[model samples]
Target: MATIDLTEATFPETVGAEGTVLVDFWASWCGPCRAFAPTFSAVSENHPDITFAKVDTEAEQGLAGAAGIQSIPTLMVFRDGILVFSQPGALPAATLEDLVSQVQALDMDDIRRQIAESEADAEVDAGS
Candidate 1:
């Protein structure tokens, strides 16, 4: 399947709906982004169960900014509407595949809960 282009208007519904989705934040002008595009696309095809979407920083500035995207080819993986893995860089195909496998191995529910608890702890610490 062709990769989906995610913009601010459709970002939430697409990434936050359900299941595992990997969102690639990229820009057309970026060489690394161009190079990584096909690899990412191939991964999407290889893993039909996962939804792979790309967001063009140039076109989806708001959405990119909201995601705190500071570099081209930032990859974020979400499961069951909660973010699980996030990394910034161009990863080789094998590495990317391994990452997907690692994510699959994780208990995302506990991961998300831990993240929330950590954030709350930080907030409480800051307030004191």
Candidate 2:
């Protein structure tokens, strides 16, 4: 499996899709981001069940800003369109693999349900 190129156009469909998604937020000019690219690609190949996507901060500033990404090489894991984990930094390959496994082991159904409840609460607040 190869890493999926995530653009602002495809972000909603990709990240918000019903599945396990790993999004790598990066910029081409950042040294750490460049260094982590290959590792991210390799991880994508290694984990066929996980959807790995890359967001170019330079080109997709809106998406990056909305994600509140203040640094390069930020990895965010989402399960069923709900954020499960987020960290800023370049992780070693082994650590990155461990993160994927850890996320996979979590109760994704519960997370998704929680997210739905929060969203509903927000909607009610907005309407009030």
Candidate 3:
């Protein structure tokens, strides 16, 4: 699927859906962001099942700020409505493909269990 432009309005619904969603936070002025755009788009074409979305940080400052985006070309991967990966930098195509494989291979049930355990631990610590 082609990369879709994500605004503050569409971001939540698009990334919170059932499947995998890869969001590229970028600005047109950044050199790395420009270099990564083609690679991001090319990878999206190969992964039709995943939603590839881009948020222009310059235009969507509020959304980017809310996401804690401190750098251009931040890539975030969401699977099953949970954020599985987030990093700042432009990744090579091969690395991006490898990341896709890793995310696809994740057992979400185990992940959810781990999250629950962590939250419970946090609650216990808070009470202590």
Candidate 4:
């Protein structure tokens, strides 16, 4: 599958709809982002079931800021409409593949349980 070019408008619906999605936060001038593009795209083709999307930070400044993207080439993985991983830096093809495997192996029921517990804790903390 080809990588989807995500704008601020489509970001939510695309990432929220379902399944596993990998988002690359990048800018045109960032060297690391350029270097990582091929690896990301190649992985996209390898996993047709997964959605691969890119957000051009330069164009989506508000979205980048909201996402807390401190550096270029930030990769965020969303599974089951929840963000599972986010980090800044370039990843080699092997690392990307391993990450994909890990993400695919995650038990989303457990992840959801954790999310619910975390949210409950946060609410309790706020009530305190």
Which candidate tops lDDT?
3
| Model 2 clashing-pair count | 0
- Give the winner by TM-score: 3
The full ranking of all candidates by lDDT, starting with the best, is 3, 4, 2, 1
**Please, what is the TM-score per model?**
0.88, 0.86, 0.98, 0.96
lDDT by residue (7-95, candidate 1, tens digit) is 88988898888778899999989999999999999988898888899998998888888899988889999887888879899999999
lDDT value, residue 58 of candidate 2: 90
lDDT of 2 by residue, 33-94 (tens): 99999998888888898899999899899999999999888999987777889999999899
Candidate 3: TM-score? 0.98
2 or 4, greater by TM-score: 4
What is candidate 4's lDDT per residue for 53-100, written digit by digit as tens? Answer: 999999999999999999989999999899999999999999999999
Model 1 whole-model lDDT (C-alpha atoms): 0.89
List runs of model 2 lying over 4 Å from the truth: 113-128
> Which scores greater on TM-score, model 3 or model 4?
3
Predicted candidate 2, C-alpha RMSD: 2.4
What TM-score should be assigned to candidate 2?
0.86
Pick by lDDT: 3 or 4, better one: 3
Give the Å error, residue 86, model 4: 0.2
Q: Candidate 2: minimum summed lDDT over ten consecutive residues — where?
A: 106-115
